[model samples]
Target: MPTDVTYPILNAQRATELLEIAKSYDNDTAFPAAELKEIGVLLSQVIGDDKFVGSAEDVAPTADLLNAFMLLLICQEPTSPAAAQSALHIASLGALAGNPAITSRGFRLASRYYDALQDSEKAWAYAKKAAQAGDDAQLIKLQNIAEQKRAAEEALAAQQAQAAEAEETAELEPEEPEERERTGTLEEQLNELRDRLEIAKRENVKEHSEEFVDINRQVQLAAFSEEDSLPASPVGVAPNPSTALAKALSILLESAVGALWACPSFATRSHVANKSNEILRKYHLSPEYATLPAGMLARFYADAAGNNTDTTGETAADFYGLAAKEYSRSGNEARELEMLLRKVEVFLIDNDRDEAHDILASRYVNALKYTELPIAARWTVLFSETLRTEAENMFKSTQVLMDFLGRHPIASARSPLDFNALAEVFELLGDRYTSANDAVTAREKYRVAYELFNTANNQEALAALAKKA
Candidate 1:
């Protein structure tokens, strides 16, 4: 029912105003059905297509508010068809855009929508989503429903199979012992099985429904996941999180440290990093304390997070130095390696890749001294990030990086070394070779990566298609 039409994209201030208007909307002060419909369409259009990003700091907030508006609309008119459709559209937008918060809220509304429609399967599906979003009651209800559904389906299948087997046995029974009356004839039994099959298929409409909302057109527009990746605060300084130091770190991590470095203002980043470290230090000084840098980090990809502490004129190297010492005191070698990686990354960021790459080479050998297997593969990725094919006199460093990973750790695919990280290293090397216009070498690097992860979904084909630059 919605049509394509570009209205002037509103700014953050205007988005806020619209949110207030939506919040205040009720039957008495009704925003016309037409206006609400158009807003709904635009909300899906902008975010689904990924065209909503803008230079204004309000961009992310505006997107969030648009989702909030739809939630408010559904809350106001819980029984309306239009409101149900609105909720579905918002859920679809969240799915396509991959916004977990919006997805959670959308599914909550959708559960009620499907329940009102008497579509039990869909109602349960949406209910399950809401439960996953942290609804305890719904989770209990969903589990019970799932058990019931599974048992019903299994029973139905067994009945059908028994009917088929009985039909087969009847054919081989030599006229049922001379004039024996047939009990539930094969034709009648088969018909009964068919009826049950139809019923089963009908109940399965949630997974097989013909009704669908196409979002591919909009998905194509979102060339990157940048908006989801980098969520900005307000126009000025973002507030320091009010929670405890540990909780605050978790909150920041939710937005991601990568996104924090991507913020528009260096000063804001400085403030955040400085505040976080200050809290970390405070905890260390306290009797009961928590650390910000505590995590398994999923395999070999060391946390070489960009030291956004650069704006304060104090380098990330200094931070990593302090971390490395603390980790050393605790005898945490893995963490020490991670902190040392930050040190190497600082050199790369400062455009001195050779220095860090060389230092890492020695560390790689030293690491082998303590390991059961000679697996220095993770550091190869650390070395590869700083390679500049364009630079002169860096041939030795590049050679060292290549030689180290070529041995290829004999670890399982499930090894502690992040296979994905190693694959990334291979891809990056291919990219470097591609940039240098050495297509032959680029293809070789890609092929090596292919051999590392030889699954059906492997990027081997895409890697093979790299053209000379």
Candidate 2:
């Protein structure tokens, strides 16, 4: 009896030793089915938390172990999908516990189980997780599966519908022989006519659609067809050459006046006006020539003499007034006002502050009296105010400046000067709020200052808080 018990113990020990050897081989190349089953039975018996099954680091042959365990679990008589899934899940967790490379393998196993069970939602969930975990292969596989499933469903529905129609047609066939044939023929003709009518209706609807305009435009392109022709220009005699030349010269003079008025750069303005006069002379027309047709002459000039001389403020203002009168005579009120504004701008640029202010104030007040012109006139007033504010920092009231900053936060937030101003205001507000010990208001002011500093990309200030922390 002692010998028999010793033999059984020795055999069990030998079997375990062989199992370990087989596992080593499986780890390197292939896992033998018989050996894995034997090892699984042994593992099921003695495996416990305290058995020193070894750490993940010790399990260098993790892939083999996982595969072997999965095979053993799946080969059970009443193989439970849930059990297989759980085994795969646990194995995957073990594989990915410390190894990022093996993480995708775990996710892939989970996906496979979910897919095998036809649980598409769970499969997609695993697939998305795997994709996020950096598994390109699994992501592509899941996408393909989804596309194929959709295509299959669509095809199946179409086939079923076709089959049902065929069956209906067959059932109605026998009743349509003699009298039915006559009626059926008429019906067939009518149906054919209806189909044609439907097609015509659809074509008409499509023709009237916005898409037709685009299609027509495309077909009309010269590049698309060699036979395409350009549209004819309107036929009219050229304007009297002298008059055309004079009008062009006048337009150029007006542009120069506008330029000088807007920015009071004398040399540039005189140069432009002189060039216009030269072009008029070259084309045989005078500066004061009337009855000039506008279209015959080009609106620009290249070169002219006498531009080097300095232009006085009065000269600029006079020229601008004359240009406005010429445009007004031609019924071009928009151009006339534009020229007037240019003159005002030139005056402002020339440091003729009183004249510039007078012009703007008079025009603005007059415009307000005309209710019909109020909206456009209001825009001009606003533009004038903006220009004035831009000219002199001393003219800007503190409240007005702050309101401007509030309205144009992006512009105000851009420059260091604006940021400094903002910070100063916040600091002052913070002091006022804190003197009364209003913590919330004080904190809000500080927060605004901090945000402004950050917006201005002051990294040093941002890091200062962290250092204190």
State the lDDT of candidate 2 residue by residue for 297-319, as single tens digits.
21222111112242334445554
* Model 2 RMSD vs true structure: 28.6
Which pairs of residues collide in model 2?
A: 243-292, 261-345, 261-346, 262-346
Q: Candidate 1 regions off by >4 Å?
A: 1-317, 350-358, 367-378, 384-395, 409-411, 415-417, 428-441, 450-469
Segments of candidate 2 deviating more than 4 angstroms: 1-34, 41-47, 50-56, 81-97, 119-122, 163-469
Full-model lDDT for every candidate: 0.47, 0.44
- Could you give candidate 1's per-residue lDDT for residues 112-137 as a string of tens digits? 66776677788778877764654424
Best-performing candidate as measured by TM-score:
1
